[model samples]
Target: MTNASDAAGDEKTKTANEKAMAGSETDTTSPASPTVRTEHEDDLDDAFKYLHDHSNAESTSIDLAALRRKIDWRIVPIMFVCYVLQFVDKVVINYAAVMGINKDLALTKNNFTNVGSAFFIAYLIAEVPTGESTSSHGANKVLTHILQDISSRNFHLESGWALTCLSGESVAQRPQEQPTITLFSPHYYTKSEQAPRFAIWYSGLGFGQIIGGLISFAFQHVTNKHFKSWQAMFVFVGIATSLVGMATFFILPDSPMKAKWLSEPEKAALLKYVSINQTGIQNKNFKMRQALEVLADPQLWLLTICTICISVSSGVITTYSATLIQSFGFTPKRTALLNMPSGLVSIAAALIVGFGVRKSESRWAWLVLCCIPGMIGGGLMSFMPASNRAGLLAGIYLVNAITGTLTVIYQWTMANVSGHTKRSVAAALIAGSFSIGNIIGPQTFQARDAPRYYPANIAVMSTQAGGAVVAIVLFGYYVWANNQKDKRQAVEEGLSSSAGNEKILWENLTDKENPNFRYVY
Candidate 1:
């Protein structure tokens, strides 16, 4: 009886091995045309039948423990540090502008505004290409190269700025006439010089974000100190990012299936894990037509619109929160300290919402929740202007909290998108919209509204409310669409309802394909 059972088990194992080998061959030999719609459905059908009907529980290939072990540690922490530093470096310029950098440079009001707007302009132009490259290559490699290039690009610019500062300081002390060097002119200081300063800073902002989640993934054990700026933060970030890039060459896997860090048992498990959910590219070809199809999705348009509104609304405060607070009666140092809390609020909000979305498997809840504080903050600051100082401070903190939701927007897109090209393009477009909004937001803070900027506040309040409404509506659409999909799949597959909660749709994979993929309201 024992020998008979062993022989039967051996036969079953042999058959399973043969099937897996055949599947491998099929995947490798499949047509390169995404439009071909090759054997994916057939393979899925077989996988579904086996998992659904068979009692062969032991035939599964899933090992969560190994997956946890294979992930690289350097990616996530460095990414987070880089992002936080990027924001700090970007915003600190706003502080410096108000401090002495503007007066020292004698930057005309119009020129200063251009300087600010220039950051986003370069960001808008570079983002799409960078995002596309990041998508085609991996985020890690792209991030590393970008950091190196941008850092090298900025090294001389910063040195020039520093020397210019020294010259300015010397003139300030000696009370001499300004030199005929024409620092602002294209001949003396070209766009090649000044433009990079803007580009690098904004690019750094996007760069931080592009890889921020990976930071969360790798640095689950990190603390707040990891993000703070006192410890040569920018320099550290440049070095760390470079190092991570070097290390990732060995440690970072192209995909779960391609991870060399994993054993054969672990690789199989990882593939199974990824396969359980559909992401439009089931080893599908990456094509320009599919890219265009993604672009044609209306959901992408809605996202771009929402991003613009949100950027306009939230960005105004990011540029001037400290200045606004100083107008409220804080000293320069105190203003800096006050802005620190707002920064912390943003970081906390990002982490909390990131984890919450991943755990609850609900992007809408976090999106809606984060938007509320900002909306309320904007409203309170605008309408309740005569309120207590503490209340005003609370409002400002909440406004800062809005900073992290950009991550929610991107992650939500990533979760919904499976096609590599589509995700890459969509992320860049969304980022471009954000840059446009940022450029517009700060410009609205005219000199006439120095202290309070009541008109700007009102505009921000309106936009924040608009953003909140958009989030709620999008959430409802996603829920309804998810249900419709589950129903369709059930009826066609003729399979008993197995909780369709894990269903991945084509529209979801396309980044804009699904009318069902509501924006992260």
Candidate 2:
């Protein structure tokens, strides 16, 4: 009496149920036992397929600690170098401004500010398409490495004394993939471990700041008649970045499943271990429903607003810090030297928050803590007399504390969001929001408000405060959502909320759809 499609569906479901029962009955400690298949094989995450084909009971006995270490050593360094190069490439112009880029380009009025803003505008435009492509394809190492190579080449070409605004626009379009690198860790880490891992790579921002300063200082001494100091610095960094890109292409794996260094048993064990995240390893299916859900999701909006608010301060720090430092009457050489300490402050803040989140699991508290220093710094910058160069410099360094907050936010999105399609969209939206704030950030520094730039300083203080409040709201929302899920599960099952939770881990459900999935603030 049933139709062909219904008969086929029933057969598939029956087979899946049989496989599940068989898997459950097998010896848990036996290395040779076949992988367990879930009841909803077609709808479940791609990780389920990997487990069915490659994993065994041996995964239960593998030494997870040793495996984690091996994975870390292989991948983390490549991630760190990529981040350092990305930030350095983007911020080189900030140093160039001090090293006579403005005079060389004959820029006047708000032209420099426009150049800064142009990059983010391009970033914002590229974000959605980039996310779609990464989701449709995979966020594999090969795709990312190719983007890095292209970015390096773009920087190299731009260094050839192209028109300032045009060069900024061209270079801005390429670094969109850099944030996508953060997407790689969820495949390799659990929710508890991702914060520190993310911090390790994100700290490259600090290193980039330090290295950019040194590079600028070193190149400022260049006396070549044919090449300006900024141009030489760009060319040198571009070559170095291209080489790193080449290295990454060869060294990095697409995913834990594809890692050549790991034995098959090791790969299986690692996959089994990270499955607790409930956020699948990879799923190429681009569900339109999932993408549409991102538009209505309250979490996405709140996180977007928070990202924008915090990134405003980030924008100010990234593009204008050198110019601000130089405005205090320091020479270009001294300005470059002074900028080095800000990097140290950034590094310290990132390490503190990274470890703090790992130990305390209080991401909301750390986020607020970061904002406090930024607020203090902004107040000093806004109100302090121009004569107090030392106080202003201290304020500049303290503002770098907020950079750590972005790292926390990055890990938050990965830990909390699930359903590969939804996660991809959320990541892109959050990154695009960052670009929005950065776009707003440079424009705040109008030419009329030069030197002290009171309005720009006040904007930083306000945005930091706003970000803190939104983070608290987001924390509360997660708690409320978790409570609702617990209540619903208790009522439906007449038992504990966690009953039969493991079966749903690989079901490829979004945070909203998964009753067992708990959000971490």
Best by TM-score: 2
Residue-level lDDT tens digits of model 1 in 257-298: 344555545444333333322343222235576578656765
Instruction: Name the best candidate (by lDDT).
Output: 2
What number of clashing residue pairs does each candidate have, in the order they appear? 4, 0
Candidate 2: C-alpha RMSD to true structure equals: 8.5
TM-score of 2: 0.90
Off by over 4 Å in 2: 1-40, 141-175, 494-503
Worst 10 residues of 1 by lDDT: 175-184
Question: Tens digits of per-residue lDDT for model 2 on 377-426?
Answer: 99999999999999999999989998789888988888988888888888
Report every candidate's CA lDDT: 0.47, 0.77
TM-score of 1: 0.66
TM-score of each model, paired residue for residue: 0.66, 0.90
Colliding residue pairs in candidate 2: none
lDDT of 2 at 179: 49
List RMSD in Å for every model shown. Answer: 14.3, 8.5
